[model samples]
Target chain A: MPDPALPRRVRVHEVGPRDGLQNEAAVLPVEIKAEFIHRLAGAGLDTVEATSFVHPRWVPQLADAERLYPMVADLVDRGVRLPVLVPNARGLDRALGLGVREIAVFAAVTESFARANLNRTVAESLALFEPVVARARAEGLRVRGYLSMCFGDFEEGPVDPARVVGVCRRLEDMGCSELSLGDTIGTATPGHVARLLTDLHAAGIGPDRLAVHFHDTYGQALANTLTALRHGVTTVDASAGGLGGCPYARSATGNLATEDLLWMLDGLGIETGVDLRRLAATSDWMAEHLGRPGPSRALRALTHRDTPTPQDKEP
Target chain B: MPDPALPRRVRVHEVGPRDGLQNEAAVLPVEIKAEFIHRLAGAGLDTVEATSFVHPRWVPQLADAERLYPMVADLVDRGVRLPVLVPNARGLDRALGLGVREIAVFAAVTESFARANLNRTVAESLALFEPVVARARAEGLRVRGYLSMCFGDFEEGPVDPARVVGVCRRLEDMGCSELSLGDTIGTATPGHVARLLTDLHAAGIGPDRLAVHFHDTYGQALANTLTALRHGVTTVDASAGGLGGCPYARSATGNLATEDLLWMLDGLGIETGVDLRRLAATSDWMAEHLGRPGPSRALRALTHRDTPTPQDKEP
Candidate 1:
C-alpha cells in the first residue's frame, strides 16, 4: 500500500514518439509513428512527447513531424497532452504553426555536450530558448525546460550537483512549468541521484516542480527514477522500445523502456494507468518496423515468457 | 568528500569472469578468460568471482574452469578473493577437488523459477544445498548463499519479502557467510527494496550479513543497490562491461554494469578500489573479442569521449 501522504502514482511522460524515434537510423513511416503515439496515449501516459521540430539536417528521422502531429490531433480532441520538442525559435515557430499546445526546450549542463550534441554552448542554448519560452507563454502554450547532463556528462566527466541546481533554477525562473534533470549519459547511480536531488531540494527546487529523465545506457534509469519518486518527484520520462541513443556516445542504449517502467510500477501497486501488455505490443511493433531487435530488455522478456509460440516475430 | 562515517572504498565482487561469461554463447579461450580475471584483479577489485564448478552441460561457457582457476590463483596470493559457484554436492565435490577456499550457492524464491531453472521447488532446492553447505564448512571453505527472484519473477509474479527473509535465515543456519538477495527479473523499485530490507532487518538479519545482487533488467538495479547499501549491506555483485544476461530471459540484461557502479561510487567519494579506466578497457577488450559492444552505457560514453575519433558503429 502507498503512503496516503505521498503521491501514489507519478506522471510518466512518454518520449518514445519524439525522443525515442528521432535518434534511430530507421525513418519510420508517418503512419507507424502516429499509431505508436496513439497507442501510447491509449495506454494512459500523462504526456506523450510527439515529435521534435528540429531542422531536418540535425535529426532526419523526425523530419516527418509536420504530417505526424496533425495525424494525432484526435488525441488533443480527447484532452490528451501532446508536447513537442522545440529546439529554437524556428522549431518553436513550426510547432506553434502545428497548433501544439505544449512545448519543450532542452539544454545541457556542460558546455561540451551543449556544443557537441545541441550545437550550442550552455549559456548560448539557454539564451536561445528564453524568447521561445516567452513566445509560447504569450501564445497560451505550456513550456517545459530540460537540463541534460545533470548528473554526469560523457565528455566533461562528473557534473557538479550545484551546476544542476543552478540550471534548474534558471529553467524554473524562465517560466517553464516543470524542470527536468537528465542523466544524459546514463552515468548516475542511486547515491549520485540521491545526493543531487537532496542538494537541489535544499536549493529550494521543490519535487513537484521537477522531473527526471534517465537513460538505460547503464541500466540505472529505473533505480534513479525510484530515487526521484522517493523525493516526491511526480514526473518521469520514458521511451518506448527504449529506442533512443546518443549519436555522440558509443554503446549507449536508450531511455528506460516504458513497458518495463510500467511493469515495476504495477508490481509496486502504484497507479500509472499504463497497460504493460499493450505497451509491450507497441514496442514489438516498433522493433519490427525498425528492422532491429528492440532495445527493451523487459518487454522482450515478457513477450518471450508469455507468448505460447515464438513465431510472431513480425509486427 | 565522503562522509566521515563512510568507508573510503567498498569491495566490488566482479562476477563477470564467472557470472557473466557463464551465460555467453561464444566460449572464450581459457587464456582469454584467465587474462580477463587477471586484469580485473589488477584493476583493484578486492574480489573477482573466477569460475563455477557446475556441470559442463549446465553452462558450456565456463567448461574450462579446470584450467582457468589455477591460472588466476596468484591473485589470491595478492589478497584478492576468488569465489566459485557450486550448484550442489557434485559441484562442491569438484570444487573441493580443485582446493577451493570460497564458494557460492543460489536458490530461487519463486516456485516456478526454482523448478524450471533449478530443477527443484523452493523448499527442495534449499534442502538440496544444505548438505553442500555442511560439507563446505567441514572442509573449511567459506560459503555464500544467494536468493534469486527476491523481487518478482516472470512465472510466479510478485514474491513475498517474508519468504526471502525465511530463505536468508535458512542459509545463515546452514553456515553461509553472507546472503545475497537477487532481483533476478529487475522488477524491484527502491521502495520495495527499502521495505524488504527493513522487514529483513527487523527479522534480525543484520546489515553485515547481507549482500546485494541486482540485474539491470528494468534499469533499477543500481538504485536498488544503493537502497541496500544505505541499509548497511556492503558486498555487491556486478559484471564487467555488464556482460551477462539471463539465458531464460534475454532482455533482462546482466548485473549492474561495473563501470556505471564504480562511477557512482567514485562520485559519492565511496572507495570502490576497482580502477575505472582499467575496468573500462577490460570491457572494451571483451567487447572487441566478442564482436559486440560493451554492456555498460557509462563505459561506452567515457571510452567514446576519450577516443581520438568517434566510433562509427555501435561497438
Candidate 2:
C-alpha cells in the first residue's frame, strides 16, 4: 500500500507530435507542428518526442522536421530535452547536424513486423541500430530504444516474449538508455503482459530501464502498463488526444491517450504534473485544427457541451 | 513463466444488457434490449447479464426488467445463463417471482457513492442485502456481488482499499459466488490497482474470490484488468459497444468494452469462448442501433477498416 503521507508522481512522455502525427494523412504545417509541441510543453509535460529524422520518402509527414526543429529552437534554447526518432546512421547524422541532443532508435521484436515496418530482418535492423546508439552515446546524446510488436503482430502468429527480451538485451548492450516496449498492432492482454514482464524481469531487465508504449487498438494498453508496473516498469509513452498509428498496421488506433492516462494517475495519488483540464483543451484545439474528432474521451466529456469558466479561458 | 505450454483462457462475464443498461439514459424497448442480449449471446458470450429489477424512478432504463425477463424465454430455453440485477429484498422478491435462476446484488465500497447512488450507506446497503442473499440461497439461486467504486469514486476520492476488502469479505460471507470489484468512475491507474490488489492479497483475498469490473472513463480499464490478471483474476465485467455509465457521475464512461476485452484475450492465447469477428459485428450493429459510436476501439477499428487476416483467428 502507498504510504498515504508520501507524494506520488508519474512521468508522462508525450509522443503525439512524432508517433502521433507520423501516421496521419493530414500533413500539419511545420509551424503548427512546432506550436503543437509548444502547447504540449506548456501543459507541463517533461519530455516530448518532437520529430523523426527519416528520409521524406519513408515518412513524409515529418519531412518538415528540419524546418520544425529550428522553429522550436526556443525550447532547446530554454534547455528542454526534445528527442527525435533516428532510423539509421544517416538519420542520426541529420539529427546531429540539426543540433539535436537526444535521439530515439527503434527495432521490431518479431521478424515479420520488422520486415514489414522497417524493410529489414530483425537482426539486420538491430545491427543497423547498434552504431547509431554508439554514435549518439559518444556524442553525449541520450539514446532510447523502441522494441515494437512486443506482444502480438498481425501477420505473425504471436510474438515470443523471449524474442522481445533478446531484443531489449541487445538494445541495452548497445547503450540504449531506455527500452520502450511497443505493442505495435495493439494486440496485448494484461495476462500476456504480466507473464512476459515476469520473464523480462527475470532476464535481468529492471523497471527503471523500461518504458511501455501501447496502442488503444485493443483497449488494453493501460492495463498492460499496469501489469508492467507490477514488475517495476514506470516510464510510459502516450500521445495527446491519443493520436498516432502504425503505418503498416491497419485499423490500429493511436497511442494510449495522454489525457486518459493522466486522469488515472491523478486519481491514484500519482502526480503526473499535467494540468489535465489544460491537456483536454490542448487536445480540443488540435482536433479543431486537424478537422478530425478529438479522440480523448476524457477531453470530450470534460470540455464539450460545457462553457469554459474564467480560469479555463485564461490560457 | 507460464510453462510456455499451457493455454491462457479468460472468462468474460458480459454485463452490458443488465449492469450496462441499468446505468444508461436511453430507455430501450424490451424487444430492442432482448435483441441486444440475443446479439451478445450470438457473439459467443456464454454469460450475459440480462436485466435488472429496480424501481422505474431509480433506473428508467431497466424499469421494465420484469417485462423483459419473459421475453428472454428463448434464451432460457436454450440453456443460456442470463443473470438479472436485483437491488434489494423487493427486487429479489420480484426476480424470484419471475423464476429468475441467477441474480446480482450491488453495494458501493465508499459510503459516499452508496448514499449518492443508492441512497444508502455502505453498511445500510449491505445490511439490506443480507435478506436478499439469504432468500436467494433458499431459492437455490446463484448470487454475485457488484462492488461499486471499488477503485475510486467521484464524491469520495481514493477509497480505502481495506474498506473494499472488508465489503468483499462480507459479501462472500453472505454467499456471493463471485465478487466483482468495480472501477465505477474509472479513476484507477495500473499502479493503483497493483497496490490495491496487493493489499487485498495480503489480507488473504485470493484471486478466485474476485472479478474485475472496469470503466474506460480514463482509458485504463484494460490496464487495470491486466493488473488484476497479474494477481490471477480471471472473470471480468464488460459492456457491448461499451454501453453503460453512472447517472450520478455524469462524465464517467461505460464499463470496459466487451469486444475490446475479447480481442486482447484472444491475442494473449487466452480462450474466452468468444468470437472476435462476431463480437465486432455485434458491436457494429449495436452502435448503429443506438445511433452512437462504439467505445471498443478494437471493434471499431476492426469494422471500420480492412484488416490483413491473421494466420490464426483462434488459438
Candidate 3:
C-alpha cells in the first residue's frame, strides 16, 4: 500500500542522457546517446532529458546534441518529452531549430557557483535567463528552471532557503513552468528538505510545480527525495545506473540511481510506469560501454549475481 | 535542524566486526579484527558488535572469536558496549566464559530462511534460541534477538508483518531485552517500514526495545531508516565502510554504511556521537586491509577526491 502522505503516482524525469553523460569523462558517439534515450523511453520513462545545447567548448561530451536530437525525434513524435538544457539565447535557438517542445534553463542559487560556473553573478545570470525563458514560453515551449546548490555550497556553506525561494520566485515569474531544485553537493538532509518545501509552500510555490533533483554524494538523495514526496512533490529527477558525478566536488557518486528509487517505489506499491528489470538491463549495458560498473546498488544486484546455491544462505 | 517528528538522538549499533566479516571472503587475523573494533570505538562508536560464536566450520571468517574477545575486553571496561552473536547454548557458554556482558541470538521470520540458514523450522529455531536467551539473561547478560528476513524471502516472497510481530513477541517473551529487525534481502520500502513498526507498536513492542538492521542491497536502507526514526526507533545497525554482503543474495552491497548513515544523522542535527571523518577514514583503512574499495558513497566522496582545481566547477 502507498503511504497516505505520498503521491499515488510519481513521474520520474529521466536525466541520464543529458545530466548523467555531461559529467562523465568519456564522450559517447551521438548514435549511442540517441539509443540510450530511446531505451529509457521504451522502459516507460515518459520524459527523458536528451542532451544539452551548451557550446562544445563547455560540454564536449554532449557536443552532438543537434545530431542526437534528430535520431530520437521518433520518440518525441510518440509523445515522450525529450527536454534539452539551454544555457542562454544561443543554446535556446539551437534547441528551437530542432523543433524541441520543452527546454530547461540552469541557474545557480549561490553567488560563488554563479561566478565560478557562468562567469556572472547570480543576479546577472538570472537576468540573462529572463529573455531566454520569455522567448521559449512565447514559442509555446515548456520551460523548466533548474536551481542548483539549493541546499549547500562548497565555498559558502549551507544555503538559506529564503535565498533559494527568491530565485525560485524569479524563475516562476519569468514563465518557467517547473522548477527542479538541485542538491548539487548532495549534502541536504531530510529535515532540510522538509524545511525547504515548507518555505516554498509558504511563498506560494506549491509542490505541483516542483521537482527534486538530488545527488547521492553524501548518500542522502533517496532519503531527501522521500521527504519531498511526503511534502507532496511527485516528480523526481534520477540518472540511469547512477551515472553522473559532481565535477565540482570531485565525487564519484552523482544523481540518485533510478533503479534504487524504483525499488523503493515498487515496494511501496506506488505507480511508476517504468519496468525495473528492463531498466536495470539498460543500465548494466551502459556500464559495459563505459568500461566500469554502474554506481547503482540495485542495478548491480539485479544484473550481476554470484550463482547462489541453496547452501549459500546466510546463517 | 532535526525533524520534529524524528528522534533527537540515535544509537548506532556498529556491526562491522560481526555481521560484516561473517559474509566477507577474506578472513582477517584475530589481531586485525580486534584492532578494527578498537578503531571503531576510538571513532566514537559506543556499541560495536565484536564477533560471533558460531561454529568455525559454518563461519570460518569469525572462527577466531575466542581470541578476539579478550583483546577488546578493555573496551567493555571503558563503558563501551561490545556485543557478540551466540547461536545456541554452546555459543552462549563460550561467550559467558569470556565474561561477555551482551550477546545476540539469531532468528528468522520466514520458514524458508529458517530452514535454509539454521537447518530447522522457524519454530525449531525459536525453540533453540529460548534456552540461549534464558541462560544469557540468567547470567545477567543483555540478550538481543536478531530476526532476519523480516521484510522479504527469496523463496517465499514478501513475509507478512504479522508474522514478524509474532516472532518479535516470542523473542521478547523469552527474556530478550531488544530485537533487531533485519531486512536481510534488502527489499523493504518506507511504507513497509512504517507499517511494520506500527503493527509492532500495536502488538505492545515499542520502538525503545527495537533496533533496525537494514542492508543497502536495493539502496533503500537509509530511507527506510528515516521512516523508522520518524516512528521513534533510536538504535540503527550499520557496517563500517559497508563491510558486509549477503551470502544468500550473492550481492556485493550489504549493511548500511556507518559513514553514510552518519552523514544523514549529522546533517539532520541528530546526535550519534560519531566523528564522520574519523569513521570514514577507519572504513577506508579497512578497505585497504581487505583489498577492496568500501561500498560507501560518503566515504568515497570524502577520501577519494580527484583533486579539484578552481576551474573544475560543475556548470
How do all models score by TM-score?
A: 0.88, 0.84, 0.96
Which residue pairs of candidate 3 clash? none
Taking all chains together, the TM-score of candidate 1 against the true structure is 0.88
Report the number of the highest-lDDT candidate. 3
Error of 2 at A246 (Å): 1.9
Deviation in angstroms for A213 in model 1? 2.1
lDDT (Cα, tens digit) per residue for candidate 1, span A1-315: 453433688788888988788778768789988998888887777689998898988888899989999999889989889999998899888998989999999878888888887788888888888888999999999998988877666566668888888888778778999888887777676667777778888999888888899877655677678767777887888888787866665455688888767766765567787877788888887788888867776677666754331211000
- Stretches off by above 4 angstroms in model 3 are A305-315, B305-315
Would you list the rank order by DockQ, best first? 3, 2, 1
**All candidates in order of lDDT, best leading:** 3, 1, 2
DockQ, prediction 3: 0.42
B251 Cα displacement, candidate 2 (Å): 1.3
Error of 3 at B70 (Å): 1.0
Docking quality of model 1: it rates as acceptable
Tens digits of per-residue lDDT for model 1, B1-315: 344433455778789988788778898899999999888888888888899898998899988878888898888788889999999899898888887789999888878878878888899999999999999999999998988878766666667788898999899999999888887766676667777888889999987888888887666677667767777777888899888866765356668889878866775667687778888888898888888986676677657754431211101
* Residue-wise C-alpha lDDT for candidate 3, range B1-315, written one tens digit per residue: 446888889999999998888888778888888889999999999999999998898899999988999999999999899999999888988999999999999999999888888889999999988888888888999999999988877777777899999999999999999999998888778888888999899999999999999988888899999999999999999999988956655453589999889888887878899888888878988898899888887787778656221111111
Best by DockQ: 3
TM-score of chain A, every prediction, order shown: 0.93, 0.93, 0.96
